[model samples]
Target: MINQDFLSRIRRKNNWTQEDMAKIIGVSRPTFIALEKGIGSPTLDQIKKLADKLGCESQDILSEDIVDEEKYREVLLETIRYGAATDGKITKTKLAKLIYLNDFAWYYQHLESMTGAKYRRLKLGPVPNIYFSKVEELINEGVLNLEIKKDGSQMISLSRAGQMLKPNLLKTEEKKLIKNISQKWQGKRTEEIVKFTHEQLPYKICRDGEVIPYELITQQDPEYVY
Candidate 1:
């Protein structure tokens, strides 16, 4: 059975009218309305097309409901562990940019986000707001050990305190994408990564505190032409 509420949310989130969504998904307006109203069902092929057009996973479209919080926490922790393994530790800012790159770059290449974490345009660039709470949860759970020290500035380092996260949690493509992103940013200073992210179209166009839309990744930027 098709998930009408999820479909409706996806369409509205993209700012598409019912007729517009119907046309894009190759359905008549009435058919689309029926689906949205839970009076009709979407065939498997239509579900595939909807996922493709919406830039989401098929399960995301077909699943009975959205439980984003738990999934978000798992992805964020796994990604942090992956990044922390590369270097002794990853700075908070660099980790934030890495997360942003993984999401936006995946969107640029596949029109989908690996974790689908919401990001806000901040002075440091795009920052995933949920990471702070996730980190706290991990610390409480003893999955990570945090070290705070002062040099010229405050410094924080995260080290694994438990066994490595199981590999099965993320899809193969998602694991590969996160690893690729971590390797790409490895050895780069936090400032350099921040500068690079500041150049991305999403970060450039969104005002401070504004939510960066995944759709913005499809836009052509003069600085970084696709």
Candidate 2:
């Protein structure tokens, strides 16, 4: 079940029109429109072609219709922790890349749109506002720190509270979700899985190698307990 809304959301967040995306995927505009509308299903070959053009995993596109939000949030938090723990400080680009791998495009777009006053990109690039909002909220809650540099680059790292909260946040339910995701996608490339999942977790790698993030809409459903 390909999600029409998810497809539209991804297209809009990137500021890409249907026609623009169609051109990129080497498909006729009508064909692309059909895909988005869920009137037709793309073959595996078409999925691969689209993934290559989008620089994302096949799972991202495939899973759009059946995303489980609670599972997604746990994955996201874990990814953040992993990124933060890697070098004791999470750079915005690294966090962004991780988020991209998780296929949170709307959130990524929000980060791009809202990171205006707090941070700037090293290059002329879109900042992800949703990421910033989460970061900002976490910062206000004493879960993270936002370090702005004179050179316009930003550094984000977990706070003491964030560090403490990380392990506790991973309950048995989350662990199962993580295990399932890992088992399903193990040995597969992130981009490939992301594209295949395609519900809310679709991802696109920016030109600078940063993974553009998006929102996990399924997370918003209250019944979606991990």
Candidate 3:
């Protein structure tokens, strides 16, 4: 069920009238009223817009009862799966860079991260330690397999025993950006991708193991900015 009271409270707290909120969310005033009156459900995009307007996380705007850990896990696994599907195989470095790009791309456009993972400076680029841990957990549970090649290259492959991703887990915009990121970087050599990242403003400014803030995306050099 939708938390109409919470939505109404947040809207009111922002000092926005029904019309103002509706316009910001790109919905008709009557439709916004219907949503706040519990007569209609809000789609993921609407919820995201509301959260942005209200200056809160989408999960916070929707309901405080539901945690986002599972959502994060799903996104992490799906990103790897999508990267593998993009190239028939994906190296660990490439997969990490793809996820990094997706997050930055989404942030640049939406002013909010699609997956709120903290990225840190690494040899390749801004890599998320949380993603590494989550991947390890999935591997331990037989959801994915990691292979080490003779040349010391590592790759990730999906295991057949794992549950398939739910079709509606990601919003259309999110999926589109992920696919675009994968396709853009799929065939590039690991070193080339790393060089690209190194030239980007975020990776250049951050020290090793430091958290790379989303704000840094704005400092991108025009020559190679995303």
Candidate 4:
């Protein structure tokens, strides 16, 4: 079941009013209130939409289950491997970009549900500074590394310590996560496979049974889970 308290916390973190969120998600103010208050459970479709809008995975909202420190380290190692495989090194900026981009795709899909309004068109923009702050925290903890150049663009990469831990990150866990996502979005305009790259995570939008990767599917507000 979805955690209403978790939803409330995320809402407050974003400084969004219930009405504001209701408008974005295409729900009535009263319905949104009911949802936040734990008076009802949202439909599967509604949950899917909500997951996207909040820039979080469904697992993040589903229960109080928390990933322990061991699991956290494992996932971070996998992320480093995936990121570095595309390039020799994983930078902080790259990590931030990947996390934010994925979140944006999730949120954009659920925008109408969150705001309770007609889904407006979204423009891909630069990542916000708050994301950088989160990235910095990770860097300070030795999870990632930042190489700043004179040109002002920093090459953010994962640390060597992070790289060594990748194999311990269970592939079975990742496969299950992707499988759940696929089932949740079955037969929708959304694609079955979401590929994350060094540059962007492609959100393939289907048109007439044909998959087309749209640039509009870029990430917006980014948060690092670990």
Name the top TM-score candidate: 3
Q: Write the per-residue lDDT of candidate 2 for residues 16-127, one digit (tens) a residue.
A: 8999877766789999898887777667777677677668788866643232333333444565565453345655655554444334222232222111111212242323
Models 1 onward score TM values of 0.64, 0.36, 0.65, 0.36
lDDT digits (tens) for residues 103-171 of candidate 4? 334335432111111111112222333444445666788877777778665655567765554444334
Angstrom error at residue 208, model 1: 1.0
For model 3, residues 9-95, the per-residue Cα lDDT tens digits are 556456679998888888999998988777777788988987787688888755442213455566656666666744356687877
Identify the superior model by lDDT, candidate 1 or candidate 3: 3
Task: Give the worst 10-residue stretch by lDDT in candidate 1.
Answer: 151-160
Better of 1 and 2 by TM-score: 1
List runs of model 2 lying over 4 Å from the truth: 1-76, 85-87, 104-129, 167-226
Displacement of residue 64 (Cα, Å) in model 3 is 17
Model 1 score (lDDT): 0.68
Maximum-lDDT candidate:
3
- What overall lDDT, based on C-alpha atoms, would model 4 receive against the true structure? 0.45
Give stretches of model 1 more than 4 Å off: 1-67, 85-87, 152-161, 220-226
TM-score of 3: 0.65
lDDT of 1 by residue, 22-126 (tens): 887789998889888778677778778878886887776664223245555555655566665344676777777777777677767776565556788899888
